[model samples]
Target: MVNLMRYRAEAVYREVSDAGPGSGVTGREADERYSPIDILHDIGASVVFMGDVAEQLLGDSPVWDRVGVVRYPTRRSFIEMQQREDFREKHLHKEAGMAETIVAGCLPIDPPAGHLGEVAWDDVEYPPSDGDGPLMVIHVLRFAEGDAEADMAAYQTAAFAVASAHGARISGWFGVEGTIIGDGRRWDQVRFNLFPSRAAFMSVLADPSRLEAQRAHREVSIADTYTLLVRPAVDSLAASIQSA
Candidate 1:
């Protein structure tokens, strides 16, 4: 069996109403109980990306508050962490804070080369017209029950060119393995992409050439998929944590 690294991407929707600071116990309080960074670090897990969900592009899915991707050194490391008592204790906070969530595990396969370092949000360029903030798109996909390999190849060849033309860069890509936690949702692949703005992204989607290319590969290869637009929450989170 081929040993592959594991990654989990979570879509988190936090409780809407905030409980008072003095509230003995509440979902908000649970969320504030502890940060999982230290534990994740001790267990050799790295956060690939973490941010606030900015927009919903597909169905009328409930709004998500945050989206994050975590990388584990090994699949065993992931399993071991979950089995640890301390880890379980900390997880209560996550559950308390979350109104709804989806977590999916994936195997890193042919992730874009050279984009694997700690991301520098400052270096990310944004269109002058888009005053909202830097935007990122997360794609969750499942392949059809056919020649998945060939379908992927055909889709990628056409998609890459269109992506580049629209000034979108792929930050991360992985093949879905199975669920490690949360709802038992399955996927075949997941991708993170950065775009200048929503308009820029729409341009890519509306491109005649790109649409034409999709018919030849993407349409046939993908059985189901969903995408989310998000804003980087790392910088703000880091600032708050440091100040605290």
Candidate 2:
């Protein structure tokens, strides 16, 4: 799941749960206390990545505080976990800490190798080191009707030329399965882009090739999108989610 969180300024403990501090605790801290490692292990799931939002590079969605991706062995395991008393008990911490969240089921895939000529989208065979220090740009997308792939292919062909100039690459590209939690907005895909650094990402702001592609192809293909820049805390998604 791709989790975009907006934390409450102060944690609000529900009446039924008395597990966390009632005062002077930030929502993020309270959420940290909500970890259910054992419950996850029982279902053969794991958190593949977690990061704080560095900035909102594109789109008009509400600013997010943190982003995380969790993997489940199966969707049924997730539902079953929710029904467990222990899981429900721990969920209170997340409830108290979060003011809003967008939880989208994300399935990782190799980026369309055809469009990206030399950009490294091959995490399945060779995953990059976190030490490469790329900024993770999360793209949440909703495609428009008919022949979206052709337009996207054209867009990627142009956009990636500019992207390659900045030493950028694809970390992971996901097809959004469904929304687990959100404001009922439908999404098509979520793409993870990795730029060498914040400066490198910013430098491509006015690249003519990218702008032309955006104008000619990308803009017309997607009805909605959000491009987020995140600073990763931990990331094993590239290696783990390919099989997941």
Candidate 3:
């Protein structure tokens, strides 16, 4: 079945620059050597979203710099690519550039239509003052023990209500299966939310109604969570990557 792979990478570029070095390969050169997107395109995998972290809303010291999601035609395609000798060779560059990373294979689940109907891009309210572009928040969650399904449902009901009221848009949601690569941290679900701006997101946090609604569900249902705010890189680089 079609599946999505989510990757969070913490790159260490101390030894690497945007430009390549002369003789010996540097970290930047190693990153250049990794061109899995081309191979992924050939294997019918499509980029979903790729962006860099702009802020950390709720989490320990931030370690990840970039996060990306790619959809593969089938789980087998991903496995087959990994089994290829050439693919293994290309992975060396990835290892060189990345200090830490996590790759999770997830299955998409279609929840009932959320209370907050889809908000059009134009309809989203911008900050009254200077601010960055649209903000995307990544939520990595682990549900409490016993009947994870029930916990998920409870959390979603309250979260959707609060999110809808706050004008937050759900960009992506998935149930994480397990780690496919990198650090073996386990997560139950992954969600992406788009806010009009940083101001809007902050407003959401301060909304008393939202807080009251979310308190009970969040506390009882979640065991652990991580939230990262990211600026969607909509430049040519992101476009090219998506098209690849």
Best by lDDT: 2
lDDT of 2 by residue, 1-244 (tens): 7898999898888673464435667889878988888899988998888999978877776788999988898888988899999998888889889988999987777686643325453432223445545578889899999878899889988877777766676778888889999989999898887766666676665787788888998888988888888988888877785565
Whole-model lDDT values for every prediction: 0.61, 0.79, 0.64
Q: Give lDDT: candidate 1, residue 2.
A: 11
TM-score of every candidate relative to the true structure: 0.71, 0.87, 0.76
lDDT of 2 at 168: 72
Flag regions of model 1 displaced more than 4 Å.
Answer: 1-21, 24-29, 32-34, 59-63, 111-133, 235-244
List of clashing residue pairs for candidate 3: none
- In the range 103-166, model 3's lDDT, one tens digit per residue, is 8888775555776536554555553234556787888888888765665566667666656754
Colliding residue pairs in candidate 2: none
Which 10 successive residues of model 2 have the least lDDT summed? 121-130
User: Alpha carbon lDDT of residue 146, candidate 2?
Assistant: 89
Each candidate's number of clashing pairs is: 0, 0, 0
1-244 per-residue lDDT for model 1 (tens digits): 0111111132132343433354446444455464588888998775656766667675355456567766677778987888988887777567656665667776655554332223343443435254744567777777788787687676666666666655566665677677555445567787777776776677667878778877877778777676788776642322222332
